[model samples]
Target: MRHIHDAPAGLIDFLFTELLLSLKDQGYSEFSLGSVPLAGLEARRGARFSARLGAYIYHHSTQFYNFEGLRSFKEKFDPEWRSVYVAVPPGANIVAVVADVVRLIGGGGRDRVGGKASR
Candidate 1:
């Protein structure tokens, strides 16, 4: 679920509707729209600068990812979003671990098969 380059308005709506209907006919009632990175992040009171910076990037950086748009699109289907988190071992380099994860999950320098990007 990425951008529709030069696609006509409502094209995505049609495609999603068709896909959902097909899935329903195939006896699949539950559809999982994949996770949107940082879409539901929350900073507790007295949060640190890193947490605030991450939230800012998630909300504003459309060139990197359409985070807000993806969440809005998924909401149209009446999804029940559950919070998910990742844990790292104590004393590990959190920054490096997160960088690796970004490369892995963000398809950094990946090839595309058909119309979809893959790593």
Candidate 2:
């Protein structure tokens, strides 16, 4: 049962709150919404160049990526933030791969994730 005042929050936030509550009622000790794309990307000393770029994207790419907005939405659930690391093999073109991904997602291709190709 949800009360009107129980959610002064927005639609997405309200839905996630209810979903989490439902999971807790169903004996779920943990729930994961996976990693929010660019959360916790602050510029700090001794950080990787990729980390700095992520911080830039997170701060500046609002039109393309809703980094802080998603982060804020997830923060409503008080989730425990964790650092995730990725390793690349020697001499891999990580930058190019990421650029391709961004281009793909930003509708720069005839081959989007679930989009069909021209016949």
Candidate 3:
């Protein structure tokens, strides 16, 4: 899941279509979408959708959150994790996730979590 606002349009839709087709092709007729919150990430509507879609496709990201961290976070809600992949265009800037994580942790170099900026 873990999609930023910058993700390309139709990306989620295409993924869903492919996933459903793949599952049917594999003779699976029963499936359900689940959702969980990312550890320490902001809780928003987009985040909620990302988590649900991620759970549906069993997709996990490794940039901002590690498998261990995601596992721990999702385990609180008793979710099952499945492995998936994203095929990025060659030379695309795929480091946005990492950069976002850095910004969040580094607080844009101010080290602020709330209204107080760290020195």
Candidate 4:
């Protein structure tokens, strides 16, 4: 897998946008925008749609810097949390995965193992 660390911020933004667009194109009309602070609080306000059919599906993070806090927060929404995984090629450096996980968790350090600078 191509590391996000090597990509420019513009590209990363573009890719994220592309992913959203792709989800929309794939019939995900009522996509839930998540990961913002207090997402659970907002979700508890009530369904975006009527009771007959729920308006939006909550997409939540399985991993958080504060895992317990995040899990507790998301649980308030009664979301059906799912597991997601990345399929990498055989013999991929585990450190890359570790660095990626750290980065995702807001670890803002240069990727010395890959000789890449964090933006």
* Tens digit of per-residue lDDT, candidate 4, span 1-119: 13467677557446656876898899886544234222332343654322112112123334433434555644554555544444546665644654464464454544555444364
TM-score of 2: 0.64
The CA lDDT at 41 in model 3 is 38
List candidate 4 segments past 4 Å from native. Answer: 1-64, 102-119
**Residue lDDT tens for model 1, 33-78:** 7777666555666775445655776777788667788788888888
Enumerate residue pairs that collide in model 3: none
Model 1 residue 12 lDDT score: 88
Q: Score each candidate by Cα lDDT.
A: 0.69, 0.66, 0.49, 0.45
Best by lDDT: 1
Ranking by TM-score: 1, 2, 4, 3
The collision pairs in model 2 are none
Q: Which residue runs of candidate 1 sit more than 4 Å off their true CA positions? A: 2-4, 43-45, 90-103, 106-119
C-alpha lDDT of residue 48 in model 3:
48
Best-to-worst order by lDDT is 1, 2, 3, 4
Q: 8-105 in candidate 2: lDDT tens per residue?
A: 65766677789989999999999976566545767788887777776777788888667677677767788888876556566656565445545544
Poorest 10 consecutive residues of model 4 by lDDT?
49-58
TM-score comparison, 3 vs 4, better candidate: 4
Cα deviation at 91, candidate 4, in Å, is: 2.0
